[model samples]
Target chain A: MVDGSARISQDPEPRKNNRVHPVLKLLYKKRWAYYFIAPATILFCIFTVIPVIRSFILAFQEFRLMGNVWVGLENFKYVLTDPVFHRAMRNTAFYTVVMVPQGVLKALILASILRNLPEAVQTFFRGAYYLPGVASAVVISMVWKWIYDPNFGLFNFILGTFGFGPYPWLTSPKTSLTSIMLMGILTAPGYYIILYLAAMKKIPRELYEVADIDGATPFAKWWNVTLPLLKPTTLYITITSIIGSFQIFTSAYVMTQGGPGYSTMTVVYLIYNTAFRDFEFGLASAQAIVLAAIIVFISVYNFRVFSTDVQY
Target chain B: MRRACWVLVLVLLIGSLAVSFGSIGAASKWTGTIQVWDFPRPAAAEEWELQAFKEFEELHPGVKIEYTKLTWAGGNEKLDVSVAAGQPPDICGSGLRLPYILQGALEPIDDFLTAEDLKDFHEETLNAVKLNGKYWAWPWYNTLYVMYLNADLFNERGVPLPENGEWTWDEFLSAMQKLTFDRDGDGKIDVYGFGFTFQPTYLQPFGFIYAEGGRVLDIDKNEFILDSPEAVVGIQRLCDMVWKHKCALPGAGGLTTTDVNNAFLNTRSIAAFVDTTGIISSFEAHNEKVEKGEIEGEKINLVTAQYPRGKNGQPIAAGPGVGSWAVFKQKDDAKREVVMELAKFITRGEGQKEVVPLIGVFPSCKSAGNVWAGNKNLEHIVPAVEYAVYPPMHPNWNKIDEKIMRELQLAVLNEKTIDAALKEAKRQIERLLEY
Candidate 1:
């Protein structure tokens, strides 16, 4: 073996070059990776990026059935002065303020409970909770419309059993937004719960065992070891929930129709009505851009609020 | 061998193409699909439409008809979006509102209709479909507001019905008050005196406004004058019915016309309500149920009455509702003609006569009206047609209607003062008109 190695080492080595283009070299190295991601990248460009750019352009154009004309800032001026747009923004803000935190907290608590259960029971509860998450929002909204009917509603019926008089749920302006928010908090937390549980399961088991050996209570172990470790997951769920709550439209559309004096109006609902109902696509596009800005601002604010430097 | 095979394949391709083209060229028949959309009609009328389409297909062997029935609730929005996308139906049954015509999506029927066909239609009905001095749609049927009285409830309460289908506003108010009472000695009222929806499309209140000689949009001035004194009084009376007198249901702001109709026919919880003549069939069915002892209430002698005369002593009625077949701009002249023919056939032929009794809508064609003339069920329909006010024809009335209805609802709910609501609505409408 020594003699063969000595002979192989005596042979001349191949030359290496440093003259290849960096981009071409990179392409050669990661060709398989690029090939795998190409389809998804092309789809995103076509469906998401291109439409977004077009919507921005459309915000400054007066769109007609025959043609579109450039009318810079006119649509923005209309949106700024429109009272309905203001009301829509306020309603969306109210919904985000109430629903996002409630959803996150409920999801976190349920996920904490789910993590401690036996594996078999945990699977059952997770499936049960996630069932509603799989349902279409429109179908859920239609069911909720019946549940909010003043004459015969499940909520009023339950309240009536306790000797309270019937209360108008979706019919009254006073309760319409709250009713929609309540539906959101109750039905949608399941998605976050699954996410949180998956994150919780990833925590090192040794940390919990060490906390137990140090005479830590279950709650103390969760607080001291689990929560800080789950910071990234919390931040993600919080950001997504806030963005989702800001875009709330289906319930307002299917159940209330932004009615009872526009109490349940959401920004997206207004955009839809402006574009399709009023045939003001330019103003609708401006409204959509404003909504996107709001979602971006809120998402950044959430990251600043909840993001923490914690590592295992 | 390979060269021979290539030549053989080329020959076969050319031969097949020639055969297909030759067959198509040999036929002299017109061939294409005509798309037709209509606002939702009753099952009977829908059957009539299907039968008529079959007949049309048979008359023209190569022509095909694709029909889509749309609900009134969100049909207009769907139609608007489709038209905006430049894929409008070749023909559709719509109200022929000014906004649709102003969009230049409709084809004027001016050149298509012969003088005889034009003469066959009611002149006023024909005028209803006109904009910019051109006929944009073929009038099919028309519906106007009529007061539907639950006669059994009135009789049980000893409330005198409107004499000769006429009443003054004071008498109407008095009747509404007399008709309201609590049963079972409970403080809670089970039966409301009047059934009126706050829904915008259910423009029963427009009749009242018209009765007052008040107009909403000043078409000449191109401004909304909803805050005018007469209009204010008209809206105030409607609000008073819901809030001050509590004659309407507590949930009036949320109830749709369908809900009001249900309360009248099935629940028998309302004494009287104003609606279009389309409710006659539903009312008749309720009476049949009562006669058969299927329901607990006594048989109702459903009667139609005129809207109460206003301070002007005029019983003017208006509906923002009309039924007409509109022709869209089709690129091909032949297809356009085919669509117009289909529209004419539906509006003037057997289809027109078949839908009147089923839906209780008055036909726009005088000859079609003759089919149900002297029919006891439609006795009030023809009389009510005389009072039908053509809704304001401004291009922006759709948005104006929504704003007025929303603010009017706010006033009715006591969330804002009626004056404030009207002023705000007028401001909103002004902004829209400016746009």
Candidate 2:
């Protein structure tokens, strides 16, 4: 943080008889930067910032077209007491508890395997894994629905050929939540894999060479050198994966539709149903605010747990 | 001076009379663009859908109707959002007792329509439109969900058809067991006897529930009664078909309407299912294609039947929903009147005649009387509309429908007991109606 005066300009003196005001000079210096940022800034404020602010206000009111009545804490109280909301919270928490670790591990393993491959092979594999991510979540969910179908799905077909019994992957309430989380864990977290691979490249070769000279095997070297160095990247992936798992919706919506009971319901999906399906916008806003608060608290806790000081 | 005063008095008298006539003219004359939204489904909004707009423009010259199209997926939500933003279309089909009516976003049809005008529509449609002793929308069309059987499949399995398309639960189950058989020597079953979807407001499957004399809401529309013993028996029968009998498709509760429809028609795996009149229309359309060698599929000998009866002697099904046009509340009295006229013109005989062929729905108005005289597919299905039970009128009914349908799915999946499922649904619905 620079002081206010230092931020204006590094130059202390102006040209003799310069007509421009100090403020105008400062503004003119950053004119192109302002011009470049204005469109994005304005649009961000209009679409994202304004809606978020309005939703926050809406969280405190009974939303009505004619007149929105101030009913402070009422919607929050309703959400707290609602059994469905409690179920959704439990589902979301369970999904995160299971999904976050598996997602990070999947990405880490894939990235590690790809890191040692030939450049051409690695590129092809990366693209292959990322291909599914390129398609919309709705489309992927539809494909997964076919794959999980008990009667005619690919998974059941394979199992049937071996004379193993068919199990309902998404239909039964017992497996619906697990099925949803498995989708998240299996959907190729390509973005995180790329991040890990990039971070792995930055790890110093000297550390691995030292481990090798100390009679360490490849796996031991990886554990001592590669693993410890990727802490920052792992933390990034973990926090993001946790957030994504909590917000899992499209797969659940397109597949089980939060059903076979409330087994597959997530907080975000429930919020959507409460607002759009039930037309309880105030309650929905309140639920969303609560979710945001939860995310912030979790993110802070994650930072405290995962922060690292390894600079090399 | 006297001549000058007389001249001024004559001018003043003429001016006052002119002003009074002008006010009357302004009150009667309506102009400007009436923002109209089309039916949500694009397929439903064929060329003939614009007939009402053209007619309105022809009758009231200089008045423009700005038409907008909405998709079925989020159309109602769009209308609700528009209303909240104070820019709802002048006319739309927001249903009779939905949020638009509950929130006072639409005008009551009774205000603009006379008793004589109401006479053209069937009493069933009118019943659907009436909410709180006031009609909320113009009755446009009627729908009756019926159980459709693949008669060819029945014949192949040597299963006897129900007597007069009416059968008790035992008879239906026995027939279903015969129809469900493995074609190949493989141990796995090849064809299932039944399939149905459990989507929100998808009421076709609920026909079976009503057969057990199970009702969702009371007359006052305030409580959930779906957890009754009869209702439990009703849902249990469907569940038994899946697990105990194994005569139904696995994971049927998660199947879509399209999935079941395709299985009944194209895939030809499932022998039977319950669906709206549109399925019969679709069957006819597909058979036409098959005849022309346009597509290849199994022969479709569509058989329409009442939902199988349970403890209740008579068959019961859900229907009697009047898909109706409604006018949004307008500040200008003249504009509102014109909008009402447009709504009426769009829903009456000529408009019904023009769109029914494209949409394949039975018209609610008697004046559009028997548009299905030559259309054999829909003609036979019309009589079943009499056996229809209207869905309960309530604002939270959509959410309640979802809760009940989810419970139905859970029961069918054998994830929960039928009693537990319906009770959970009841608990959820009671929570929705807590206010």
Candidate 3:
């Protein structure tokens, strides 16, 4: 069998001694493919990979004015016992629980509705929904801050019309976290909706037609065809949303400043305060690593649940 | 593929060329370009810089001043990064916080000033700029916290003002109770007697600890004395004002400078503990409303007094005033000479006379105070300045203040008992001192 395979390979390239080998020729023919791929890979390495590796190295060391000293596990130990770190972890967990499912489900529902609309109407709605994603986070946070102002906000004005008392949306410890989470939910979900809509549109019409011929009802067809086809997009969105939720910082930092007594202090905000405010770069790096590990674990779990060899 | 590589190369070449051009452009002689980093004041950076530069340019023609404005919130970090990067501005204005000086981030100006130049500034004001036996910064403006009362509220309640800018704790509480009222006749109270803030400096009246002759930190021993009897009494008095007397608002622990100022401006509260600078602006902004029949009681009369005297019978107020100036060491010799000259010019009697009114910042020089001696608007600041006690001058003051203030907030908000909070603060401060 080896002799026969070798003879077959030799027969296909009889004049190879005078020129480049066929394999080399094939690779050279596809040189543009490699060229096209190089830019994104280089960018990804520089921007994402390098920083990530640097952050990992920084986690085990003590950063001081003079130089960094390697004190393995010391920073991690400090992070575990630090009250501020604990508070940050608790706040981030609470925020994730409140924000992630709500964002994902709302996007899914909106995408489903949009999918049934006329093509032009769907396009307009998609663009309108995705507009907030294009806005600067600082501007969005500021606008939301004004809207949630207790003294003369639009929210308070609306409540006043209904004979309800004004709520301290961003001030009171009781309502501040929820109010910010609501902003997060509203500002996000739009991009995910657009993604899901595109994914749904890509589902072959023949699948639904076949289901219909098999006497599948609208709901049945959607359950058997549309939902299954959208699983990969849903998985992607879920992992991203989880990671995004874990790193929620700008809104809380700008609006409430983790105040009314640490009610809105997310893990990333704490990391920022530790590194920049207190200049405890080592502790901040450790906290960041812990955060990253949690994200990786959740992503892996999501992949296991969503992607499998047993395809429907 | 070849075209793409060429494009990438061209882009990189252009980037490098642009960078080189920028470096060459910046390499030019000073040519009147005075780089300045100013923190947020009511006056815009450009407006203030232009005014100062225009005057300087007239004196020394063919020079331009470049000004960069930094926000107060992150100004220190930005300044630190610039210094670390070895590209700090020729001049920087910062709060008279000690860490910057201790860290050698600022230049010492002792060599620049002669004995005669030094003699013009108040000794205490001079002390504020000194760190480790060297003058690290020049004192530009000073402000002290003072109690401002709404005269209309005091008159209506028949509560007499302090006899001589001094009142005991009991008398202060009695006045606060009488002033606090439910205007709508509802069971719930709409107005608070005192708009007390839970800031570190606001706790100054409890200066009984220092008056009782207790130190904030034993610099020699490097330990905190915050849990001392004097500190306990001061802290207890603050808590009593909130929980027992009910004179202070419940959310006073979280009150911001803007919130307290708003309360005073909107007539939502009777009294406010604020800085002299804020009072100046408040009066200026509402002077017309006071003249008209707009504010309640047909003419709002605002009066200032010293913080209520502690039980020791000696009135003590926390006077932590921050000054701005140009440091000589931070700049090259030529830049240093110019900065020193500019500093002298600005802090001179003439500069003070020109800038103080526009900025509303009190002058650091005694001569400048004389300029505003008879002005009614600036009259309130005079008494506060006279008796203002400076906060402890330590390199770690920022850390100390943050820990102390956090504890004070907890104690005031009843989140922690006074003893526990004070102990925790002392422990934290001790840790800070070691660093």
Instruction: Indicate the DockQ of the complex predicted as candidate 2.
Output: 0.42
**DockQ for model 1?**
0.23
Best candidate according to DockQ: 2
Residue A225, candidate 1: C-alpha displacement in angstroms = 2.0
Question: Residue B234: error of model 1 in Å?
Answer: 2.4
- Residue-by-residue lDDT tens digits, candidate 2, A138-178: 99888888788777778889999999868888878888778
Please give the CA lDDT of all the candidate structures: 0.79, 0.79, 0.70
Candidate 1 TM-score to native? 0.78
Between candidates 2 and 3, the TM-score winner: 2
* Colliding pairs, model 3: B32-B63, B32-B64
**Compared with the true structure, what per-residue lDDT tens digits does model 1 show for residues B133-207?**
788898887777788887888888898887767788889888888787787574556678887756655578677
Regions of model 2 farther than 4 Å from truth? A1-28, B1-35, B40-49, B52-78, B94-97, B112-120, B160-171, B280-299, B309-315, B332-338, B349-355, B366-368
Question: Model 1 Cα displacement at A294 (Å)?
Answer: 1.1
Over the stretch B307-381, how does candidate 3's per-residue lDDT look in tens digits? 666655665555556566755244457566777666666567567666666666556766775555666545544
Instruction: Give the interface RMSD of each candidate.
Output: 3.3, 2.0, 4.0
Q: Score residue A56 of candidate 2 by CA lDDT.
A: 97
Q: Please identify model 1 stretches exceeding 4 Å from their true place.
A: A1-46, A117-124, A135-168, A185-188, A308-312, B1-92, B95-100, B107-127, B132-135, B145-171, B256-306, B309-316, B328-360, B365-371, B374-377
- In angstroms, the error of model 2 at B18 is 22
Residues A117-156 of candidate 3: C-alpha lDDT, one tens digit per residue: 9999999998899888898888998888778766446897
Each candidate's number of clashing pairs is 0, 0, 2
